[model samples]
Target: MNRPLCIAHLYPDLLNLYADKGNILTLKRRLEWRGLEAQVTLVTSSEEARPGDYDLVLLGGGSDREQEIVSRTLRRSRDEWKAAVEDGLPLLAVCGGYQLLGEYYQLPDGTKVPGLELLDMVTVAGSPRLIGNVAIESDECGTIVGFENHGGRTTHHHAPLGKVISGHGNNGTDGHEGVRYKNVFGTYIHGPLLPKNPALADFILQTALDYAGIDVKLEPLDDELEKAARTAFQVRRMNLSEVAAQTP
Candidate 1:
């Protein structure tokens, strides 16, 4: 008998700010729809989150204050996360989680907050704030739609993250958007992308499957559900492009 896939979510310190739990629920439901039992574990600041025990790990967005809280906890767990990544454990980190994985984050006052150094990226915090919908053109995949409300822009050194297909990404200026290091996927979009974009969810889940060495047949979703998800993603993409063009 195959056990259910275990997914662990790092609660950090704040889970309500960006309301990123939607991503987790989206994945869980999607898996359930595919007849796969999914189990979720939330590891808070007080709890121990060992990445090796889980098949998938997710981290949500948070504020600077909350980032501090999560970063502090991550600093202690850095070794575990680094090891997990090195060992090819799947990870999905968004916004503040993305920032904390970078080399550093520069505040508006020119104060530089050190990051976890997990990914070779730097975030310039005091920059053009991008709030609203975002469209990204993936190098590995296709159009991805989500919302971005952030005060920082992340830049990758030596290696570039994923590409931007539409909307202003990473400070609403840079074409360099999102970070993809190894099997770790970090993005700034926070509309809890999975619910509205099932392809992206499939992409992530497939990655997890590959990592776990599970060679089951990839199930195809129903036409109605697929159409709905694609339509939702398109609406978001078009709406964001309109907003971006009108903003300036």
Candidate 2:
């Protein structure tokens, strides 16, 4: 019997400010729809999260205080995460999770929130939070869309996931949206991320499959509903673009 692909959702309780569990659900069902099995394990504490137990990992967004709580567990399990990434374990980290994976996330008052150094990046708190719908053009995944609501401006050294097509990305000034280093993906777009972006979801799945050396080919899924969702957003994006063009 084939074993199911295991996924670890770290600090799910504390890091689910944007209902990111939908990202988990998206992965799980995408597998099942292809006649494959996927098992998601919620890992809230360091002790329960064994490094070698998962094929992939997900770290969702959270508020500053919530992230502070998760950071303790991450510190305790930092070695495991670092090792896993080195060994090519696929990881998707969003917003606060993304910030924590970097060098530091500095607060407005100049307090430095320590990071795991998993990604070579830094974030500084900024005024006028970037909050809106986002669309980015990615060579790997076409036009990816999501929502962003953050006060931290992040600067990183790596190939970004995509160029900003619609809203404020890592920083409002830079036209980049997210970071892609090896198999780890860090993004600020939440709105539960993976639901409408099937291409990005499958890219993550494919990377996990490759990491695990699983040779099974993932069959294409019918995504009419997902297409409908994207169509609606595309119209809204156009309207926003028109509005921006008319602005001073």
Model 2 per-residue lDDT tens digits across residues 86-154:
888899999999999898889888988888888889999999999999999998999999899999999
Q: Could you tell me the lDDT of residue 115 within candidate 2? A: 85
Estimate the overall C-alpha local distance difference test score of candidate 1.
Answer: 0.77
Cα error, residue 230 of model 1, in Å, equals 4.4
Instruction: Give the whole-model CA lDDT for all candidates, comma-separated.
Output: 0.77, 0.89
Give the distance in Å from residue 157's predicted Cα in candidate 2 to where it truly belongs: 0.7
- Kindly give the stretch of ten consecutive residues in candidate 2 with the minimal lDDT sum: 43-52
How far residue 33's Cα lies from its native spot in candidate 2, in Å, is 0.4
TM-score on alpha carbons, each prediction: 0.88, 0.96
How much is the lDDT of residue 217 in candidate 2?
A: 73
The reply for model 2, stretches above 4 Å from the true place, is: 45-47
